[model samples]
Target: MQEKLNQFNLLKKKSEKQVAIGLVIIVVATLLFLTMSSVGSEELGQMLGIIVGLIGGIVALVGAAGFSKVKRTFKTEVLSAFFSEVIPGTDYIPDRGLAPVEVYATEFLKRADRFHSEDLLKGKLDDVDFLSSDVRLEERHVQHTKNGTRVYYVPYFVGRVFRFTFNKEFEGYLQVLEAGSPLTNRDFQKVELESIDFNKKFKTYATTELSAFYVLTPDIMEAIFELEKRNPGRIGLSFAGENLYIAINNNKNTFEIKMFRTIDNAMMEGFKNDLMVIKDFIHTLKLNTKIFKRK
Candidate 1:
C-alpha cells in the first residue's frame, strides 16, 4: 500500500506541475494579448506578440488537456489497485457506470439536465449480483444579465447509487424518498406507513397505496431506518421488478483521490469504510434472503 501511495503521489505531483506550468503560460499570454498584442500602427512587436500570445495560449491549453488525460489514467491505476487490496471479491472499473436507464427508472429523484457517474464497483456477495457508482446529477440554468448570458449547472444529487438483484420479482413499482428536510422539496402522493417515525423520515410514492404497503413491509421499513441510522445520509430507494436501487445523497465523491490531501492509513481506512457501504447495505437490507412471491 505504501508503495502504491508513493506511486500515486509521484504521478500526481507531475500532473500538477504540468497543469500549473500550462496555466502560467496561458495567463502570461492573456496579459500579452490584451495589453500588447496590438498597437495603433502595425509594428513588429505588435504582430510578434499577438502571434506568440494567442497561439501560445492555445497550445498551452492543449498541453493542459494532455495532463488531464494523464490524471485520468493515474486515477484508474491507483483506484484499481486500492480496491483490489482492500475489498475482496470486488472489481473496480473506473470507466464504467450505472446504466442511465435504471437510474431514471428509479423515479425517486428527478432526472437532471446533465449526469455524471464514475468509479463503478461490480461484484457478487452472498450469491447476489450488485453494482454501484458515484453519481452527480446537475440541472442547467441560464441567467441573462447586463454582462451577458451566463450558464451554470446546479447539482440536484451528488452522491453514490447502488443496484442489487433481489430474490423475488414484483411487478409494481414503489419509491421512497427522503422527506421533511429543509434542503429537499420533492412532492408526490405520500404513502404513510404504520410507523410514524418512518413516515416522518421518508416519503413513499407508488403506483397505488396497496403497492407501497406490499413492498414496504414492516421489516423493510425498519431496515430502511436502520440503514439511515448507520449511514446517516439522505437516501432514496426504489423497488421495481426484481431489482432494488439505493441512492445515497451524501454530497461526496468516492474512490477519487485529491491532489492535495495527505494519504495515510487513517484515510485509507475511511475509504475502506465507504466501500463497506456496499456490504453494509446488503447485510442491513437482507437483500440476499428469499422473499415471498406475489400470489
Candidate 2:
C-alpha cells in the first residue's frame, strides 16, 4: 500500500508542479507583452505587443498541456485506487496511517455450474450437519463465547459482495494499496493479481478491530449497481455510527471490508477476532436451509 501512495503522491506532485509552471509562463508572457507596449514608442510598442502575443500563445499551449496531463493522471489514480481497494482478499495501508480489512463474497441465484451450485456448498460443509442450525447476532451478543456465531448483520444480495475497512494506523497502507505504487504500475497490478492471507498479515501489525456484515442472496445483482454508486471505491459503508464499510467490485467478482474507528473498542475487538466465525457464517448461507435466521 505504501507503494501505491507513493505513486499517487508522485503523480499529484507532478501535477502541482505543472500547474505552477503553466501559471508562471502565462504571467511572464502577459507582463512582457504589457511592458513592450509602453507609451514611449508606437512602432516599437507594436512590435513588442506582437512578440508578447506570440509568447502568450506559447504560454497558453503550455498551460493546456499541463492541465490535460494532470487531469489524466488524477483519473488514473482514482481508478487504480478503486480497483486495488475493492478487490477481495486484498489489504492495503493508506498514507494517513490507517489499516483496513477487506472481504469479498460472490453468489449466483441460479445454480448454473459447479462453482455456483448446491454441490459447491455441500462440498464445503461436508463436516457440518445442516439438519438444524441457527444463531442470534446483534450488539448485545456475548463475546468470544459463540463458536460459529457472530454479532454482525449481513447484507441481502445475490452474486457476490465485498467488504473493506481500516484502522487509523493502517491508513497509509490502504493509500498505497489502492493508489498504486509510484515505483511501477506493473507492480501495483501484480499486487492486485495476487491472493491475500488474512492471518499472516494480521499477526504482523497491532491492528485495531472492526466488523462488517454482508449477505448475498443470488438476486443481489439488482443491488450491485446501487452499492457501487453509493459506496464508490474502497471506502466502507457507514452503518449507524459504525463506519466499518464495504466495497463491491462486480467485474472482478470481489468485495472489500473496512472498519471505521468511531466504534467502541470492545465491539471492534469482537469483530476483528471473530473474523473466522463470520466467514463460517457466510459459508453456511450457501446451504439450502430455512434454519438460518437473521437477528
Candidate 3:
C-alpha cells in the first residue's frame, strides 16, 4: 500500500487520465441518449451531441496545458536555483531580449559612442565612489606571462576582499554595462559561461559550475582573477572531465565553484609529485585559442 501511494505521488498531477475518462463517459452518454430519444427529435439530438463534444475537447485541452506548464516550471526553477548556488559574487542577471545580433550591435554602438565622446567627457572618475570595500575579492595570485599570455590563478576559495584594476578600456565601457564581466574587450563575446544540470545527469543534491577561458583574444586573458577570500584555507580543487577540465570549489564559505579547461599534457608527468616535493603546485593555467570558437 505504501509503494502504491508512492507511485501515485510520482504521477503528474495534471495527467490526461481524467480527461480521457470524461471523454469515454461523454461518448457512452451520447450513444445511449441518442438511441433512447424519439425519431422526431433529430435537431435536439444534434445539439446535445455538439455540446458534449465541445465540452470533452475543452477538458482535454485544459488538462494537457496544465501538465505542460508544470513540467516547464519544474525544470526552470531547478536550474535557476542550481546556478544561483554555484556562482560566487554572482546573481541571476537574465539576458532577456538579448540576441547575438542585438548584443553585437549594442557592443558596437558602445564602442563607437565612447570613441566619439572621449573628448566631450573630461575626467569623470572622481564622480564615482567605486565603493572599494563593497567590492569583494577572493583569491589573489600572479602568473608569469608566457607566449604573450597572462594567466591569473586563484585557489578554490571564495573571498570578499580582493582588488584588481583594469585598463581605462574596461573602466570606460564595462563600467557602463549592467553586468560586469571578467573578460577583456575582444574576447568578451567568447567568454564561456556554463551551468550543469545535476538532476538531469544524476540524483544528487549538488549542481556544478563550469566556466572556461581560451586564448582567442588578448582580452580573454584578463578573465583570470586573483582571489583573496575570508577563508583561504578552505579553497580546494576537484578533478572532473579528466585533463580537459579542472574545478575549484569554495565549500567553507559559500557554495561556489569555477571550472576551467586545461591544455592536454601541459604538465610534466611527475609535475604533481615534483610540486609536492618542492611544496608547490602548478601556479599557472594555459589554454589553446581554438577552443573558444563558437560551438
Sequence-dependent TM-score of model 3: 0.26
Residue-pair clashes per prediction, in order, are 0, 62, 11
TM-score against truth, every candidate = 0.77, 0.26, 0.26
| lDDT of model number 2 | 0.30
lDDT of each: 0.75, 0.30, 0.28
Candidate with better TM-score, 1 vs 2: 1
The worst-scoring run of ten residues by lDDT in candidate 1 lies at: 180-189
Q: What is the lDDT of residue 105 in candidate 3?
A: 30
* Alpha-carbon runs more than 4 Å astray in model 3: 1-11, 22-42, 83-295
lDDT of 2 by residue, 44-113 (tens): 7566656756665665566556545644443344433543333333222211111111121111111111
Q: Report per-prediction Cα RMSD to one decimal.
A: 4.7, 23.1, 22.6
Best to worst by lDDT, what's the order?
1, 2, 3
Report the number of the highest-lDDT candidate.
Answer: 1
Report lDDT (Cα) of residue 203, candidate 1.
Answer: 77
